[model samples]
Target chain A: SQTIHQWPATLVQPVGSPLSLECTVEGTSNPNLYWYRQAAGRGLQLLFYSVGIGQISSEVPQNLSASRPQDRQFILSSKKLLLSDSGFYLCAWTGGYNSPLHFGNGTRLTVT
Target chain B: TQLLEQSPQFLSIQEGENLTVYCNSSSVFSSLQWYRQEPGEGPVLLVTVVTGGEVKKLKRLTFQFGDARKDSSLHITAAQPGDTGLYLCAGAFYNQGGKLIFGQGTELSVKP
Candidate 1:
């Protein structure tokens, strides 16, 4: 079975602070990884996606960035956080095209 | 941009009642997926419909993919309180690797 692990699960940071959220998948190799943010409790905005190591496609222009260091390890980072950056962050993985995505528990970040 | 619009942005219904949620799009999709998210957790994959006019049933939940692959519907029979959560519909393009377009999401609240 495939499982995705994401952390810190919850985060509270000050404005202009750096941010790092990690996601890893087990039982799969070279899977497609995605980063998404949900605000106002509905819908999700795609942040980034990776099909292989060292390759990342950013979906939106924002302060946040994503990287896939290893085949199953993905990281979402930001040099400086904004008040609008706070939301529910989710990490998901899929086998390939037309495959259903499996998501991690998610991280709730609050920027104060 | 290819967008998926979900109707009835919010739904509140009594237990044992039936409800339907629709996802519409002007663009064609190779596949459509349904997900359910609980509070404080990531969205979980409920089902995926690939072929046009395909219908899949999972317990009391019934999902249908439109003939043109431009829409989908989810009908829940004898809804229970446990079914209360956010429902999301995602569509995938043909051979698009892992890129998925998400709908605005439907918040369903079933009162027991």
Candidate 2:
């Protein structure tokens, strides 16, 4: 079975502070990873996706950035957090094109 | 950018009631997926419909993909309280590097 782990399940940070959310998957290799942000009533937006290590495609150009350091490890980072950056951040993985995405528990970030 | 639009942004129904949610798009998709997300968790893939006019069933939930591959629907039969969650629809344009675009989502509350 595949499992994804996301840490700092809940985060509260001051405005302009740095933010780092990590996610990793187990039981799969060379899987495509994605970063999504679900804002209040705004739907789930694709922030970034990576088909392989160091191959990240950003969907929305914002203060946030994503990196795939290892095959199954994806990190979402922000050098300076904004009030609008707070949302439910999700990490997902899939095997191939058009495959079903499996998601992690998610990180609830609150930038105050 | 390819986009998905979901109807009934919010739904509140009784436990024994039946409801239907829709996902519509102007562009055709190679595959469409339905996901359910709980309050503090990532969206979980409920079903993926690949073929045109394909229908898939999971317990009391039935998913149908439009023949044109531009839409999909989710029907819940005799919904239960446990079925309450945010329903999201995502589509994959296989030829477009398989990036998944998501709908705004429907927040369903099945009251008991």
Candidate 3:
């Protein structure tokens, strides 16, 4: 069984502060990872995705960035948080293209 | 940009009622998936349809992929309050390495 873990299930940060969210998967290797953000009453927005270590693709231009340090470890970071950055951030992994994705519990980030 | 549009952005119905949620797209996809998400939790994979015109059943839920692979639908029979949550549809193209483009989710509330 594959499982994903995300840290800081809930976060509260002041404006202009740095942000770091981590996601790790177990029972899978070299799986594709993705980062998504969902605002209240809005659809999810894909922020970034990584195919392999040191490979990251930004889906939309935003204040966030992503990195794949290890095969199953992905991180989402921001140098300075913005009020617009507040939302539910989700991490997902899939075995390959066309495959269903498994997601982590997600992190509720509130920027004040 | 590839985009997926979901209809009835919000739905509320009685527990014994039936409901159908639709996902539409102008571009064809290699595969499409349906997911259910609870508040404060990540979306869980419900089903994935790979072949065009494919239909899959998961207990009380039935999923169908359009013949052109440009759309899909999920039907729930005898919905329960436990089914209340956000439903999302995602599509994957052949060359995208399984990266998914998500739809504007449909929030369903099944009341007892």
TM-score for every candidate vs. truth? Answer: 0.97, 0.96, 0.96
* Candidate No. with top lDDT: 1
Where model 3 places Cα greater than 4 Å from the true spot, the runs are: none
Candidate 3: residue B90 Cα off by (Å) = 0.7
Candidate 2 CAPRI level? medium
* Backbone clashes in model 3: 2
What is the model-wide C-alpha lDDT for candidate 2?
0.92
Residue-level lDDT of model 2, residues A54-111, one tens digit each, is 9999998799999998999999999999999999998999999889998888888899
> Candidate 1 lDDT, tens digit per residue, A1-112?
8899999999999999999999999998989999999997898888899989999999889999999989999999999999999999999999988888889999999999
Chain B, model 1, TM-score against the native? 0.96
lDDT of each: 0.93, 0.92, 0.91
Looking at model 2, residue B23 earns an lDDT score of 98
Q: Clashing pairs in model 1?
A: none
Colliding residue pairs in candidate 3: A97-B97, A97-B98
DockQ of each: 0.82, 0.75, 0.78
TM-score between model 2 and native: 0.96
User: What does candidate 3's lDDT look like per residue over A15-73, in tens digits?
Assistant: 99999999999998999999999887456788999999999999888899899989999
Chain A TM per prediction: 0.98, 0.96, 0.97
Please list the residue runs of candidate 1 whose C-alpha ends up more than 4 Å from where it truly belongs after superposition: none
